[model samples]
Target: MSGPRIDPSLYRERDRIPIRRAILSVSDKTGLVELGQALAAAGVELVSTGSTAALLQEAGVPVTEVASVTGFPESLDGRVKTLHPAVHGGLLADLRLEDHERQLDDLGIRAFELAVVNLYPFAETRASGAPAAEVIEQIDIGGPAMVRAAAKNHANVAVVVSPDGYDGIRRALAEGGTTLEQRRALAAAAFGHTASYDRQVADWLAKETGERDRVLRVEATLAAPLRYGENSHQQASLYTFAEGRGIAQAEQLAGKEMSYNNYVDADAAVRAAYDFERPAVAIIKHANPCGVAVASAKTVDPIASAHIRAHECDPVSAFGGVIAANRTVTLRMAEQVADVFTEVLVAPDFESDALAVLSRKKNLRILRLPADYRREGWEFRQISGGVLLQTADSFDAERGSAQHDSSGWRLVSGEEVDDATRADLEFAWRACRAVKSNAILLADGGASVGVGMGQVNRVDSCHLAVSRAGKRARGSVAASDAFFPFSDGLQVLLDAGVRAVVQPGGSVRDEEVIDAAKRAGVPMYFTGERHFYH
Candidate 1:
């Protein structure tokens, strides 16, 4: 007899056999007792295994054990229980074939018309960080075998993989018995469930055994469907990785539906907020940091500075931008943010008064993230017919040495730096690390005043930075994401009255640039690190 083909259309045909026999097995056991009782009330025979059989028997439900059907006791620590031909043959045999019916009769094998099976708690076991032996023991073999058999024969056997499907199964059995279309859907779910389970096992083993060649396992769920793509007419949806902390998991307290651009800019802004230790805010536009500021509690309100400085950087560009706050949103902060027309606002939390004020504008999206939330793992991007994955930009300046630190770093030629000048230099260094490629940033007393991003030439970016700062560029510290190729860029910044500068200091003409700063009466620091975002 040929194996049963799992086809939904076959089950939906007018002439179809109703499911009369079912095999039930699960690791979770949730709702199993009630489901068994319902099946019994429907006059369906129940065949279970191991603990499941014992549980059903204790509950006064009739159940046939796999060993009883196979006429062999479960051996090899229950690993060899359901692998017998008597079990799989019954599920795989085509019920509509006369020769298959004769073969089953000769072997005295009863066909299993339905199967409800779930694998062991592999994810839960690995998450517990248990002993290696214990984790290995939890790796199930017989469960997957039975599930695959049932799913592969879904045309004749209904396959159920989740407890959530119990109600649907019960309803079908109560009304007109299981239909072929329902069985086919259950078969698809069964395959997906087993695939996910196997992937988890592979990932866990790779981590435990340190296998370098194993494929990385990734799982994600849909966050929401966006209204459109980059434009209004395109199609798009948001999906977030399931393994770690991410912005997709943030709680939406009171807000409108988030758009495609909102998610893009919001991710950029939140990453910038994590770069600072003090009270800070980052305003992002088109996936780039347009304005970022760090203000002392007494000197200036960080939230107010964020709105003002971001707008000042590029008033035309700040329109419809995404705003993010590392701290909770206060009433004062809400008022300042409300002044500007923004697409979304994300913060750790929002005060009642702040929410009340912001609610007046119904279209603005407000997201409340937990205070201690931190990003995890790497990010994945899809290209044309391929995928690109890399570690996320999860860098914390306070925790370790900046990536640019190197032995080549030295004060080639600059004015003798004072204590205050060095402090400003470090502040400028941190600010520069947050900017994009060919980046130039100007800050005074740790507050970012001007920024230039995505310029092809470093000198052009320097000019743009100074131009944006205008009068504010004077007496401010300047930082470049990369080492200046020539001394001309330093001259432009010095001519603008930039008091100090910080950079990676790797250019071959480093001596010339340092000499230029020293000649211009400016103090410079070489952090031996460069941060260039593309």
Candidate 2:
């Protein structure tokens, strides 16, 4: 007839868990000694296993071994350590429930206030190419289970999965106890750590067995939240995996926080820059290259000349484009970069004085990257209710060599091109791969003087490229990502003074197109390779 009376001591708001006892188990020993010494000084009891207990004891920190706490020796090559009822009871018992507290007391199990656990280095082991048996053994079962239990009951138990959390733990210890909010954050971090660990394990297993299920598992950690996506109305954030590359791992030296568009445009520009070995500059806008230029060997200042040549290609369109250089930025180059209305600038390195000069623009995002940074393995694209994964695009340096026989270029025109024209043809062909479909690029004097991309018809792209090139098109070479379906597209370039053309020629009317090029006295080479970007 009456509701059960509740114990006031069992339920309270805004209570901090007092650190009476903690379980410490980790494979990475970074900062472990300092943390154990601090916990011992605070009069908190620490229970550890194997090396952890021995290290703490040797450091003169009072730590109890797990065998003593559970009254059982570790078995199965130490795999069964910390899996006892005593450990789980201490971690999962709810202090706020009278029934839970009574059960713990009846069993003589002490409640653990905190748990520090870092999983085995499975990623490192896999990367090292160890034997399958050895790699599988490094996958920890007990660590994730313990951490998950502590995280699930974070209301009374604090869990730390990595040494990165040691500082916060120490600060909370100094303040006498961990706040509820702090405990919640630590729990979230612990869950993330465990999730990544499991994802990596799944990936390794899939690779080992040559999985036919095609089940995909991608693990990513949050890098930062952007102000907005491509538009202010949309929301977006950046992510990095355990193995990050390119802009995801780049170091930001100065300027405002990078936006969604900045990241996309910067990545595109940087990828384009590495396609060339010479000192080169690429200006990108709306995920397409507005202009790209490589420094001439004879130029007095290679970097400055590259920037000037690239900027001169389409000065109006380059207003707010992102700029990327493969080499370090000198003071002179920085001065040139500052003169433009650039949204972001990325390079391998920058001079101190150059950085000082560029810092004048407060909104310009500056990032430093390695000269050879690029993505590896698979790339993914998400669609409605599904996902697509494929190999990443890479520029093959051997494609340019004559001995490779990669493309099977055929002469369908006036005569073979000169060495300089051949070089320009190869350069423009590589740059065109990164542009959208129906793309055309003009290269001459070690610069991309003009680019036309995202066109519905091939003829229109040719006209757009010729217009952008202007006087530079007089002696420049052009590249097409695919075969020309009709002869009209070739005629447009011939009218615009294009001297030579390189295309992946496989059209049904290929003879007609070659006849048109021959009629116009412009040499055309068929690469027998097609690169399409949607």
Candidate 3:
């Protein structure tokens, strides 16, 4: 009987020739020495370029230089080394193609069965705050070329682009060489590697050139798949952009898969946590701050303050809310948090004991994010047909005084404001920025007593806010999203015993409103700018 007929397309001739040819060129030479040693032990010929060849040779692994393979020396500061046809032809040619085989034979070029290339550290170089000249110099030209070539011909060539893939490639080569499936997977990884590297370069260039009309390259990694979106039937996934800091990158130390609502509330809590300078905790629900408090550094019990404030605001709303803190969570903190039925807890760090205690509640999501989270650069919002982009609202804490300046236009009449009352007015002004449109905030001292947000009418919001404050509304300062149109709203607040008020001074009846405050003896200051949050 004749020998079994073998299909030509089934495998490359090199599958019969054995794994002996390997090309390695990388800007990151991590694990290159060990990888080269493994290939050498397998009797593979190592072809390399520049510092890679030097490193391999230094490690006693024989390496044939790219200059030897191309018959042309590297020039123009190593930029012209691997761009030659000899290097690319070896990588891109299909061993299965008759024409490709013929061309290689006629050119006296040896096909490279394996290509290992990693691009220059463009992201790292740019991150160092170096000059543009230094950054431009580090951009890789030939490395990507070799990688693309190998990846394009993945049917016959194996491409490895990451140090993490070194051991896998080594193991495969050691075990009868890489299979076609392995080659295809490596090829996909190689393309992804090059694409991300190019994106970094593109984004940097765009920033340098101020090209807003240019295509926006948003590269993000999926953090998790949400259980559901706004509704149970809706599907959702969380993708974190590269620039975001805070809970976007937080690692889940424990808990069930986060839902869409959980992520939204967590973000609100984290933002509030970042806003406060001292050790603080914020409990957020339905994308609104429910309760927030500053902790004494000596005691540093954010959990207690958060719980008490939550109950004060509305204990029912606090249930299943997200909690965030700017400091490490302790056993005491965890115990207090456990008392409330919270959906998630986010902190900078958590003690081992705290983690153990919190672990008992298996369904609660816990996240540990990096501290010092702050918004940077631009803010983007998606509308029905287009994206709206703007610089993030200014968080310039130093730009304004915490003390109210009576020299400014006063909308309220007859109110003699003391220093303490003035401080509360300033506090209420800052609090207003975080509330929704037509919002009103009532605060006594540094803590928020009542918050009315997302109301259609300004006066109604003031009434609701004052009602929420209850007895605390008395002697507290009130802030309006816009100037009071009529003295009726001022009369309502004064009836509630609100001692001071702050609002934007753009109303036509500003004089009437100032007289109302003056008549009510409630000190009122008007900031020139309106802070209306839609």
Top candidate by TM-score = 2
* Models ranked on TM-score: 2, 3, 1
- Candidate 2 lDDT tens digits, 1-534: 985686777774646767889999999999999999889889899999998899999999999999998999999999999999899999998787878889999999999999999999999999899999999999999999999999998989999988899998888888988888988999999998898898888878887999844677777778999899999999999998767768888899889999999999998898788778889889999989988888887977788788888888899999999999988888898999899889999999999999999999998889998555766567789999999988766665443544123245787898988888888887888788777889999889778888989999999999999998888888888889899999998888888888899998999999999999998899999887787887
When summed lDDT is taken over every stretch of 10 residues in candidate 3, the lowest stretch is: 401-410
Count backbone overlaps in model 3.
Answer: 12
174-279: candidate 3 lDDT, tens digit per residue: 5887877788888998998889988898888888888764565667778778788999999989898766775677888999878888887887787766565556
Candidates 1 and 3 compared: the better one by TM-score is 3
The whole-model lDDT of each prediction reads 0.78, 0.87, 0.78
lDDT of 1 at 16: 46
Q: Candidate 1 or 2, higher TM-score?
A: 2
Clashes of 2: 0
TM-score of each candidate structure, all chains considered together? 0.84, 0.91, 0.87
What stretches of model 3 exceed 4 Å from their correct place? 1-19, 179-182, 296-307, 397-419, 481-491, 530-534
Q: Which candidate leads in lDDT? A: 2
Give me the overall lDDT of model 2: 0.87
Give me candidate 3's TM-score against the actual structure. Answer: 0.87
In Å, residue 103's CA in model 3 sits off its true spot by 0.9
